[model samples]
Target: MSRRLITEVAGVIEAPVERVWPEIVRTVPRTELGEHVLAYQGGWWYRGEWSVTPVPGGTRLVHRVYDVAGQGWAVALANRLFIGFRERTRRSFAEGLVHLGNRLGCATRLT
Candidate 1:
């Protein structure tokens, strides 16, 4: 049987919704699977979403990765066991958040 794995990470950008939204829309690498929904294609059966929400002082950006079905389980196991997938993903997200901050000329607080 296949097991599903889901991971989520979020950060707050210290900028207004007006400022943050555009950069997120422009910089976040994704495929337009639907209106207001962006997807990142992952290794073999993995998929990801980049969701942005407006907050009082800034914008909250959440990234979610999902692994489903048989192929997904196999890839997730291999990545976790042999490749340290969690750490790598966290690092990548951190870097991307920093880049986004730099682009927006403000600070990004990871939560």
Candidate 2:
């Protein structure tokens, strides 16, 4: 069995993409650090990418995580063992972005 968990929080910044991109790279936590590929910013997780996209006025960011364990009781046990995983992950990303906006002196909206 494959077990994956994904969560995303996105918002638009008031600045242009040029200014937003570096803020993302420099401000986002090291744990969520990722590189920009084309119009998307994403990082390598165990089995997924926390991807970000550039919008007209600002950028959109996503936080995603995938936990994979092959087969049976082990997977089920692990899943049950972890609680509030999604909420915690989501909160972390959301807070990170909010903080980034504050630091950048830009307005943002969760979209």
Candidate 3:
């Protein structure tokens, strides 16, 4: 039996998806790469995905974290014990967007 817990954060970068893709690949290496998508798996329970899409002004970058655990109860318990996990995830994603914006010399806003 497997269960998934997902968390997501999105930001818009003042650049095209083409420009943002390379930076995402550079920052997050050794992942399963696809058109505007990067997938990473860690340990046996965690999967992280980064994706970009063309928006009105620029590109929308979204990060999603998933806990896909066979032992769903254990994962749930662990998450309950981990204080501020969701907040930390959001903060980290925001910081990453800021860094990526700096690298691209563009502005980024969390959505």
Candidate 4:
């Protein structure tokens, strides 16, 4: 039995997906690269995906965290008990986008 818990955050970077892709791969070396997605799996349950999409002015980057455990309910419960899990995830993504922007020499804004 598999239950899944997911959270997603997205931002727009003022650059093309082509430009952002290499940097993402460089920054996250252990990812499984797909068309526009980078996937990372860790431990027994954690799965993370970063996807890029072309927008009018630049690229949209979305990060999603998934609990892919058979006991995902327990994982969700533990996360709830941990407090501020969602907030921390969002904050971390925001910081990451800022860092990516610095590296790319471009602007980034949460979407």
Q: Which candidate wins on TM-score? A: 3
lDDT of 3 by residue, 36-56 (tens): 889887776777889999999
Q: Against the true structure, what is each candidate's TM-score?
A: 0.75, 0.64, 0.87, 0.85
List, residue by residue over 1-111, the lDDT tens digit for candidate 2.
Answer: 364554445567676667777766664444443355222223322443445677777777655565554343465566575577677766776777677788879887766
The runs of at least 3 residues in candidate 4 whose Cα sits more than 4 Å from the true structure, single-residue gaps closed, are 1-3, 72-82
Backbone steric clashes in candidate 4, count: 0
How far out, in Å, is residue 73 in model 2? 7.3
Tens digits of lDDT, candidate 1, 29-103: 778765445877756656778877778778888887776446634655666653666667777888999999998
Give the alpha-carbon lDDT of every model: 0.75, 0.60, 0.84, 0.84
Question: What 10-residue stretch in candidate 1 is worst by lDDT?
Answer: 68-77
lDDT of residue 64 for candidate 1: 79
Q: What global local distance difference test value does model 1 have?
A: 0.75
Instruction: Answer with 2 or 4, whichever has the higher TM-score.
Output: 4
**RMSD after CA superposition, every candidate:** 3.4, 5.2, 2.1, 2.4
Largest lDDT belongs to which candidate? 3
Residue ranges of candidate 1 with Cα displaced over 4 Å? 1-3, 33-36, 69-83
lDDT of residue 18 for candidate 3 = 90
